[model samples]
Target: MGSTGERAWLSAGLALLSEQGAPSVTLERLCERMGMSKGAFYHHFGSMPRFRTRLLAHFEAEHTTAIIDAVEAPGGLPARERLTRLMAEAIKNTGPELEIAVRAWAKQDPEAAAVQTRVDATRVDYLRKLCEEAGHATPDMMAKLLYLVLIGGSHVMPPLSPADKHRVYDLLLPLLG
Candidate 1:
């Protein structure tokens, strides 16, 4: 009925998407999970397509924009420090299952694919800027290298643990010089 209600539905949709992939994010499933009715869903989102659009927007905001905002909040940190903070925030805030699920969803849905492309480009662009600020010889390549590692790591079976991801970043960060 309000923004809070909409957020609850969006959050539940994300959880469902993460656990069971996009196929399971149906109106019936969501309504059943939330103990609400289809009327409630329609009341908030108007239609399933609209809800899916909002859900993807929520994912981008939470998984990308929010992390970038947090990393940039305490300004004046050195480039390397900022990069480290960005990696840390990413590891802490993002769930590998959700990332993989959305990516898989993107493969089949044009809208999801567009969002995924934007998210990947935004992330890589941010990483490239950080690399440039750190004076890396090939900032673009270095950014791709780092981002690829993250994307690759997420798809690995069992996914990389936060500690392990941190170790990987630690090894890579020294190359920024």
Candidate 2:
């Protein structure tokens, strides 16, 4: 936590936030979790509002930017595997509770909502890129369906059994080819 830079505080803040809400993401709590002083947090972020700003940015950067870049990186998995990894990472990375917490926070804060909107757009665009790269017959439609399925499947319903996810993905492969 001492050496991980600003993200250490943000990560701790997120865990608190996911467990409770934005109100729980205080410097004292984050610093306590990290075994650091409030001065450490202030060293990276001047104040609470600034730390909150960095939290949302960090969430997007880790969850969206990092994952998407890895999937599209050079000499990795094939298109299908990449797409599978995309879905896996999309739903698995931060856990649903964190996502729900962020959305809840967004209701009271414009910055959080702005970040959410940007992240959603980035994800949908990433889905479109995957479809295009895979040469899907109906790339746009597939992107939309995949996006909606992920959103509905992950939040509205319980986690899909691995076998059931495989079954759905199998049916989706033909649409790609």
Candidate 3:
């Protein structure tokens, strides 16, 4: 087993985690669903903890790191506009089910909880700094509020339609300035 095996497990784990949450990400489930042998998972990850750690890192990189790069990419847009673009991209990238699963996992796993904390911090801090760059007088409080809205929106309701999402952005834009 090599990168192929590693990718297989990670892909299976992410699928299960997103569809059914942490409990569904068991090694046996991954092996069965991905049509891989148990030895393959072990060869790639060695243990459950290592697999989980890598999973979190992979999720972070896929979800957050790329967006960070995109938002910071050189453009004529102002910082506030860039932040708005980032928010739109983030909303597109994440599924509410996957987020809910991760949040639920955070309740039981310290590593998952820590990863959640870092994700929140990174996102909130990015908003804070962007607000600062855009000359918000109360960037700290605004960042906290905005981040809360972003996270809490899905937990509080069903998925927004595309129109609703645009409405939300419209509502949020004036506040950013």
Q: Rate the local accuracy (lDDT) of all candidates.
A: 0.94, 0.79, 0.81
Clashes of 1: 0
Residue lDDT tens for model 2, 1-177? 224777677788889988988888987788879998878778888899988888899888887898898777755667777888887767567566777788889889999999999998898887887788888987788888887665555566675644555567667767787
Candidate 1 lDDT over 84-106, as tens digits, reads: 99999999888789999999999
* Best-first order by lDDT: 1, 3, 2
Off by over 4 Å in 1: none
Ranked candidates (TM-score, high to low): 1, 3, 2
The candidate 1 region of ten consecutive residues with least summed lDDT is 1-10
Best by TM-score: 1
lDDT of 1: 0.94
Name the better of 1 and 3 by TM-score. 1
Flag regions of model 3 displaced more than 4 Å.
1-5, 75-77
Residue 142 lDDT (model 2): 88
TM-score of each: 0.97, 0.85, 0.90
